[model samples]
Target: MSALTLAAPAPPASAPPPRQLRWLLRLHRPALYAWTGLVVVLGALLLWLGGPLTDASEAAWKQYNACGMAACTYDQDAILLYKDVARYTGSAVLALPFLVAAWAGASLIGRELETGTAQLAWTQGVTPTRWLVAKLALPAALVTAGTSLLALLHHLAWSAGRGRVDNTEPWYSIETLYAGGPVLVALALAGLAAGALLGLLLRRSLAALIGSALVTGVLWIGTFLTLPHLWPAVTRVSSLRDGPSGSGITVAEGLLTADGDRLAIPRYCGSSIDPACGSLFDRLDAVSFYRDYHPRSHSGPLLLVATGILLAVAVLLTVVAFRVLRHRTADRKGAAV
Candidate 1:
């Protein structure tokens, strides 16, 4: 019977496929919950800002104003929520990355290291490289998705509000700055990268949190101060209108030109070329002066530089994290022997 059993073929041991370390990486619930709550709150706040709670007041919006001999008719209508709220809301949303950075950076990798749980995790089939990659992947995905959704919502809500009301509000004024596609994405990624680097560098939960806050604060101040200087060509001036002599002297009565080239007619009013040689008519070609003028005030170039710098920092810190993980794992293994 034993000989017969020995003659039977042994069962082949099956090799396991490579485990996806990503499955093990998960957001800490408290942090995830807080971030989700913040997102919901921001969305609700934006909706409230865009919605009309009350119509324009009859008292504040009079049908006509009695001022001297000039009877100014209040032909203007009620203000729309979009014009009043959109740009400001979008700008406020732009600031969300700071909060996201502070919260995310604080907890990112530091929490794992602090709890000693990551050490246990490394002993599994997962390599440190796979584990680190997994740690970064999920949070990066979440931040990207959140930022995209925010941008889309802003675009839809603001587009609906365009031209409905006077967009002269400070909120509306900043929309162009906040609404650029690349700027928004870069801001989000910058926050994430900053947070990840902080977490990796500190290796302590609270330290990571504080470090993120400090970095975010510094970035905000720096961006506010310097970004405008990086791309200045975007600012525009109104164009002057040329017309017949009947309306020729009307200064503010005319409309701005299509390309926004406000003329220096005031300076040319009494110049040598004027109809009256005594009346100087030096028509300064403002367009010619401004045409070749290239300004680098917009935030894009600075943002790119900042992004590259932060990305490099994040990579370096990540490398350090990998080394720390590997070294710790080797130490543990050597001790076990």
Candidate 2:
């Protein structure tokens, strides 16, 4: 009897709870490395763009300006190089939002759900809400920090070239403005949210990737169309000889009648410098060419408004994703309990 009692097997040892955050990092280590590498490269390029490249371009522009009416050699290669670098780099910076959306949709959330890893983790001790929060919070922090840094550098680079490099984009140029301000950062955050929502909804990586891209593109285009109207534009009136004239984002431009009524400028009637156009302007009772537009000063207001809207959207999407996820898994959770 003593031997039989001693031979009884010891109770099975209990397993410890899962480490959600650690496991998450291990699963997405590849994406983490890739994102880090990309940020470093872009930061270095932006620094060069704002420093040596800007200086070289400015010098070339000065030389070109000094030539006057005479043919003289200038550093054309330097000018071209600056132009190419600024264009390509700005484009890349602006495209970052879409890239993030694709990755977040395909890899971050969708793949785990598709492969049943997400379910397995839930069964192992990680609650679904906690899991989703971990996924969104960590990536959102990384994306915001990286994108904000790049945007700051891009803005400094463009600012360095402003008024000095003749070929540089104006402050109001859509791509330049978008890349060099808070709008880029906001868009990226929105993209991350959009991708996450799509992933949970579709539960398929490929479909979610495509859907995220399309949704982000639509949001961007809508912003482009709506931006000019977000802030009040200044009105400037110039003589008919100068045509409708003003800089920055043009909201509306036409002719003003003597009674202060706004009228459309005639077709093929650009300038009063042209006798035919001058005659047309006179017959139309055009007092002056009027332009309602935003100057460089309005960029701040526009950006702030746009950024606020995007952030609100991101928050809304995040909340909805959590709700949708919970609703879908509610029955399963109840049964498990």
Candidate 3:
């Protein structure tokens, strides 16, 4: 007869449920580190610009202004230093979206799909929907936080130097317009969505990268062309003798003839205050000079409108990506069955 002794039942396995976020963080540790480093570097640069750099630049500007074209000379190094820092900071901020797009298309999705790793992940208890969600959600949260911080810092730095630095960029300048508000973060999110969609559609790392960059470039160009028209521009009309007043983002400036038609200034008149220019203007019946512009107050509305548009695009792209993934997964399953 066999012995009736039975071994003690083994304790139930105590492992925690699988976490897609942990796996995601583990897989992209290097990217996580790189993003952290970028945020820290940019934050430090903005701090310096707002503090010591601003003080030095403002002081130098004051000295130069006080000199008033006399014997006094300003410090060339100080002037150059501020200009270089401002330019570099603006360029860096502007370049962040393209970097996000490149990484999202090449490494985030395309490489995994290209290598069959994404399919392998699907077989490991991760649904396609969860996989895509994890991928986009993690990066989007990090990017939004980092970019918002940078934008805040940039606004601080720019405000610190305003009115004090003679060469400071205007509020409506391209760099300032994008980096000083929420629009930059919105654009970055849009880039991420576009990259993910391209990666899913292309499934090739190099092609996805190029496609992502092109998409971002097109968005940037479109924004640049359309930004001025986002809000209703203020129009001012003055006699041709007086000219327009109060500087802003000029949409159009032309001569308003007595016949109520707008005509561009003649090329021959070229900033000359001569009698011939006056005669030409009179002959053309140019009674008033009209200027259409976006005032500084309009910046907030324009930015809000632009941000809303970009965010809507991003949401639409993400939805499309999800549908595409679902369709592809269903097709594969059907083929296998």
Please state every model's RMSD to the true fold in angstroms. 10.1, 4.2, 4.5
By lDDT, rank the candidates, best first.
2, 3, 1
lDDT: worst 10-residue window of model 2: 10-19
Model 1 misplaced stretches (Cα beyond 4 Å): 1-23, 44-92, 167-176, 179-181, 229-337
TM agreement with the true structure for every prediction: 0.57, 0.92, 0.92
- Give me the displacement of residue 90 in model 2, in angstroms: 0.3
lDDT top scorer: 2
Candidate 2 residue spans exceeding 4 A from truth: 1-18, 334-337
- lDDT against the true structure, each candidate: 0.53, 0.89, 0.86
Worst 10 residues of 3 by lDDT: 8-17
> 101-188, model 2: which lDDT tens digit per residue?
9888888889889999888877666778878877888789999999999999999999899888998899998768899999898899
Q: Candidate 2 overall Cα lDDT vs. reference?
A: 0.89
Over 4 Å off, model 3: 1-17, 268-272
Q: Report the error of model 2 at residue 69, Å.
A: 2.6
Model 1 agreement with the true structure over 1-337: per-residue lDDT tens digits: 8899789664322321245353454446566677677667767755554444112312213333333467665534443434346545667677776766776666666777778656656655556556666777776777777766676666555544444333433221345445433445556666666676677667788888788777766765565555444443332332222321221112122222336554444434323334642222223322311121123233446556655554555556556656766676677679999
